[model samples]
Target: MTPIKDTHPSASSAVESGAPGARVGNFRWVICGLLFFATMINYMDRQIIGVLKPQLSHELGWTDTGYANIVSAFQLAYACGYLFGGRLMDRFGVRRGLSWAAFLWSVAAVAHGLVRTVLGFSIARLGLGLAEGGNFPAAIKTVTEWFPLKERALATGVFNSASNIGAIVCPLTVPLLAAKFGWPAAFYITGALGLGWIVAWALLYDSPETHPRLSVAERAYIEEGRVVTTEAAAPWLSLLRFRAAWAYMIAGLLAGPVWWFYLFWLPDFLQKRYHLTLQQTGVRVGIVYTMAIVGSIGGGWLAAKLIGRGWSLNAARKTSLLVCAVCVTPVFFAASVENSWVTVALVGLAAAAHQGWSANLYTFVSDTMPKRAVSSVVGLGGFVSGIASMGNAQVVGYVVTKTGSYALIFAWASTMYLLSLLAIQILVPKLVDARENERRVVTDDGTSV
Candidate 1:
């Protein structure tokens, strides 16, 4: 049997000296790379349908409402996935939990090719949504586990940027795949990529405790800033008492639908408004997602940089979010902009801001919440966000179908970040680590917990 090493070590010991010249190994980054590709493949599968929406709708005779319902199917399940996925990761461990979710979602993605009706598509999306729910919870939890406090955001930015890459990949490839093969082939091929990823994930991923390739210096680096925790993970009900958790959840509820709207509806908007061909739309969409990649990584970097410069964790995270929020305001005018490139520029800027906002937002959770509860908290936020997304889809479909305008939705997206930030300010006024409070509470209660 493989040895199960202890998760905690003394933060004071090993204190950086490593045989005068021993270097920290990059194996942790290899672990990060695995996460990167897993996330990439995950988004690729998720966005394929959106990329192929125009063609699918035409071929399958889908009205906007029907399509909205399909999207909602995915959103509803995805929301629930966020809830259950987090808890499962906490219970069973992220390594097994994330892989299992990825495998099942891949199978569901493949099933898309077999379906010909709206109801069938909805069912398949439901399955995919539920399975894909594990991705963020697992990724966030793993990052918290593997990285020290300062490096967490940068590592998260790297993986979260993969979402944009996957989004970019879909727009660039899915349409072409449909043109060359068939629509079903797009789903089949994208889904298969995840199946392949599982092999690599299973072979490579282990907790930092037992990873054979980790160097002592690197392991020491990880432990140096991580909060020492051997206590059992707090229950979900218990975690709800914290204001910080609610702040995170509100951020999700406000901003999540906007991202989903961009992901699911942007292509159709291009088709409807610009009258672009499939190829043209894909190229344009790819460009927008590329901008998002910058936001995702840059957002994470900005906060980390501020923290390095002696900013409080709260100040750094919130400051980065403020910048992103201001950047998103330009997108409100995108709908009314007469020039196509101008519209693209505006939308691209906002999309970038959202990704940046997300990278920081995720790091914020790991920064403030105990590592053990990080996944569950994010899962809860995602669940709330998913619920909002489900409603947003319906609203979008009705508005677009009835009014033939997405002006209202884009306008709302522009202001949501500011509101979310306000909520965060009200709830998490300081950025103290929750673990410190946990230790105090345990001591006060005279309990081992």
Candidate 2:
């Protein structure tokens, strides 16, 4: 809990001197762009299976239970990978950690093209989940390193919106690829997309201080008011002591399953509820996820704007979260509505709200924790989310088999964000910076004693 001092003397001096009138540059935004694309590709790769589930089920004779098992394999592997991936990113740094993760997941994505049986697909999904787990940890850490505290939520929101973009891309392209080339081609094409990102990442990414393209003013600007940690990577288990960490974990436990349900089962829901064809499902699903893109950016922007206008960070973040939770409540009516587009609009609103909530939720880590602990804490939340997602897959499969309706699942999703918000409020009543606490005690005369 003790604050670690900034170890880089030059950076500290630069900050203290107000960067000496150095001209600011926009290089940090360039880094944010890369994160956006990486996330887009990550989700596209994962979503291909969901888009093709019906075709695969019919062609291969997969029961709902069987399909759930396949999804469960991925979630289970993701849970394991999130724990280790966060630590690895902390130990090895984002550049190398993200490169390896992209490479491994891409290979796994391509491997799906060669698999035909349920077992084969499950194995490929397991690999995909393990490798893909590193994406958010590395991306979140990069945002911490690149952006200032005030801008972190907006940056996180912008990059996080790529998830919806990826979701959008999957439906638009996956159906065409499956219809034209084969379902396997969908996997092959999306998997190859990550390699291109790897090259760009290797070429363009580095720490702000070390990055060749970064300006002195920008570096100083980013460093100002930031807690520069010089400590070794904190153990993942050690993070559990903080109430902030528990708040994040519980939020993920409640909200992660809802997102998972949308990602994996929405296509099935469309097909069952409205009797849409593959192409029709693709278009409608795209519409739903597109709304999420708007929510993600809007949510992040709202909080950032409020913070800029003199709102406390805690108030701004929590206020955005409350808005998102209210937006999600209308989805409770989605299952009862007779019109399909009406249903899409309702579900879309909920999905959008989820993204908005997620954008701020992610920013909470960098806002409250020290720089060194950001990736590890993010990894812990993801680990909890993955476990919850695994259980959700099983429950969804069971519910579908028993009742032959998505109403029960929709009801649960509708209320999760509000529930999560309450848990967050209870656990972390205020967002307190750990490093700020460490500086609280000074001499009576205000000089270091």
lDDT tens per residue, model 1, 1-449: 11124454433354344443246567878888988998999899889989988998899899999999999999999999999999899778988998899899999999999999999999999999999999999999999888888888889999999999999989998887898998999889978899999999898899987788776667776876455666356577667767888999999999889999999999999888999999999998999999999999999899889999999887888999999999999899888987777888899999999999998898888877777778889999999999999999999999998889989999999999999999999998887685464443232234434
Q: Estimated TM-score per prediction? A: 0.95, 0.94
C-alpha lDDT of candidate 1 relative to the true structure:
0.87
Cα lDDT tens digits for candidate 2, 57-150: 9999999999999999999999778878988998889999999999999999999999888899999999999999999988899998998888
The best candidate in terms of TM-score: 1
- The TM-score between candidate 2 and the true structure equals 0.94
Clashing pairs in 1: none
